[model samples]
Target: MTTNRLWRTLSGFNLSTRKWTQVNPRKARSQVPSNLLSLTSWNIDAFSPRAIARAKLILDHVLHESKPPDIIFLQEVTTAVRASLLQDAGVRGGYLVTDAEDQTAFENVPFATMTLLSRARFAFGSDSTEASEDDEVDGEGDLMIGRVSRMSLPSKYGRDALCVDLIKPAATGTSFRLINVHLDSLGHTLHYRAQQLEILANVLRESGCGGGIIAGDFNAISPEDEGLIDMNQLQDAWTALHGETGVEGATWGVGAKRRDGLGPGRLDKVAILGSKAEAMDVLRPGSIEVPRPGQESIFLPWSDHCGLSCSFTF
Candidate 1:
């Protein structure tokens, strides 16, 4: 119920917080580049009318998989929905979560971004077991610790970037960071969105991590978005893997129950910020039909937006 590591930046004060939380420190840290690195970015609509069913299916789709992606980014996750995430057994044993323990209110906002790193790929720190919920994972779940940081972005909405840094313990090895972000929404806030990107860029620069990802609901509606992407030194992973196809990459229209007149747009995206991705593809983890006895089966895309999955060389 109480926020573990809440950062509030309402007065332009950067009260960013950084912590190394341990999930599975020793057991999961041995592998290297030979292992495939992958991630999935999604914005599960927290305010959906069918929030409960949607959340259940979303968990089943991502965590129940025999082999889930290495990294996952979820946005617009409300406190109620987050309860489902923290309680899942698979999540407890298989992944390290940002904003899990001691995660204070989302600056009193209803929703915020959360990051999940597979225990198979990343290791965590030794201390902070109290921060973890209930019990720890099997076989020395607290062997190594991983780094997680959050910076309050400049937004009228209580938005912030949840960044998980995969820094190499060794001095010679390379490191990368993954950030889950939801920029300012709507078309009228282009300048505001641009400011958000700038803050993210600075975070990357100051981090000194080699390179990594920035993915989530970018609200990419205006043409200025393209310029903003380049301006922030972020490359469109999908476009690089697959050519730029405007509406083809759209992620948030059909599922939009509200239809805010924004129409169809690729509001959700996976981007590379000073990093390289091997492959990129759209994932419909939320796609499943809800069964009914006599009535026609209802289609649920899980949320208003589709998911983007990618593999990174680093």
Candidate 2:
């Protein structure tokens, strides 16, 4: 994508520090849908068929259940497999944006390793477009250092990341920005990760979207990992809406890997920006469910990572 075109896509961005007057608490709407929106985020480890099946089952339940989510954001999608899986699971509308290589030469980058799937419209970043005058051989050689492992064939799969914008129906007048990302699992250090967060922060500030939601496998636990993002600019929707702060909130480790309890800490997350946090009707980190039998519990193993979902009112 040309610089000019990229600027066009980011036209709404503004650097002004002037903030909008937050609506008073008394006027806010806190009663969200009783069933809550069912949104799930799973790593779906690439090259592992087991993880794929686990991810599919989660989707099946969400589609089958009542009070289906208005949107779903899925990460770690290698290609268009997520869309196909959703279709097979009976989801009616599917949209996706994967960072597949169209280059004839080889390069390496983690962003090229996966894709993002959502039941929303997609707007890609400008860095994805290629110009005819570009030198292919030189570009390929420069990207050799960032190559994604496990692939015999090499291409420009790791250099740049992809950004997708998921839009709800315009008639409904409800929308948000869904960013699916897999930060450098290697290469760049802590500072680099922080820089990645900064980039995202700036994007939200500029996009001027009504409600912005970012969901992904951050690859780092919150409040502990250095350079791991500080939730200062955004609030974990589950924590903010539920008013709980405890260890059980973790959402990783289930399925084939095998975990005894709720797994090891919360790595996957769904967050709302402070700019729009007040709009949330209700948010929770677990699946919406009903108590059955004498079990007296609504817990059921859904996937490797427990899903997080929320509802926002305009």
Candidate 3:
């Protein structure tokens, strides 16, 4: 099926009882500024109940804010969680989600992969003209969606990256590409991660876009690893915003015990290419805490890894 047809079919699947309105250009323009775009990336741990709850909380917090994130890039999303997210009241009302699962789906385990959720109002493409109820199915809007595909990576677990392109104010040819990836897990070595990064970098270079974003659970321990340094065009948002003092920006191992041989580390990252970075930070909800067995309590994050968000004004 075509992308527009697929999007419409997916949107029509009402897993929730609440009725949702179609994208309104006037409301979208009024709610979200054209120049400002906010994005958040998180590895929501296979969509466990606790993880989903926390993810909902984070989304709610942002949606209520004066300026909510325009797009959300999520990794480690499972088929079940994808359905749940779609059925979520807040999510249903605000965003349109698209997902690509790993090629190999284990027998009982939900297929895991990357997912992107774009706010309906702020979605890029189209002019300022509002579509009437009858015109909703015509797919006219402020955001023009284009070229979405799932590229497979060389991995035992059948990992893949979901790549998508968006044009803001459809008339303007200006566009940006967004890539969400979940590389091999701990079972893979640094060299393997490097190989995967190389494939991704090659794809980006070949695309030849003016600017774009690559973000997700890279599983790379250091900046030098994963061939990141080799990509001269892309800048690590964490490093650019925080600098040397921000080395403590750990997003993984938040729920592990010392005996588990896991501790806080920066495995997840957001890399920006050809865009001016405005701000970047880890999103840690106050309620997240790690528990200790009758010892001094430690704060455990909502997931094993914390969420990261970056803002850019082009």
TM-score of each: 0.79, 0.53, 0.74
What lDDT score is found at residue 267 in candidate 2? 65
Residue 122 in candidate 3, Cα distance off native in Å? 4.2
In model 2, which regions exceed 4 Å deviation? Answer: 1-38, 47-49, 80-83, 86-89, 92-176, 186-189, 226-232, 254-263, 274-303
lDDT of 1 by residue, 1-314 (tens): 11233332111011134232333333554344623577788888888566656776776787766668878888888887777777676776677676665557465887888777676665433333212222233333222233566776667887777766554444233446677899988788878789888777666665455676788999887878867777777787878877778767778785454635676677887777666778876666546576788999887678878777788775
**Model 1, residue 88: C-alpha shift (Å):** 0.7
Q: Which candidate achieves the best lDDT against the true structure?
A: 1
User: Per-residue error at 129 for model 2, in Å?
Assistant: 14
lDDT of each: 0.66, 0.39, 0.60
Alpha-carbon RMSD, candidate 2:
15.3
Candidate order by TM-score, decreasing, is 1, 3, 2
Model 3: per-residue lDDT, tens digit, 253-299? Answer: 65456675656677888777667678888776535544467898655
Off by over 4 Å in 3: 1-27, 31-35, 47-52, 100-111, 114-117, 120-141, 169-174, 222-232, 254-256, 260-262, 286-300
Q: lDDT tens string, model 2, 162-228?
A: 3433322221322344455554443334444455555665554553345455566555543444224
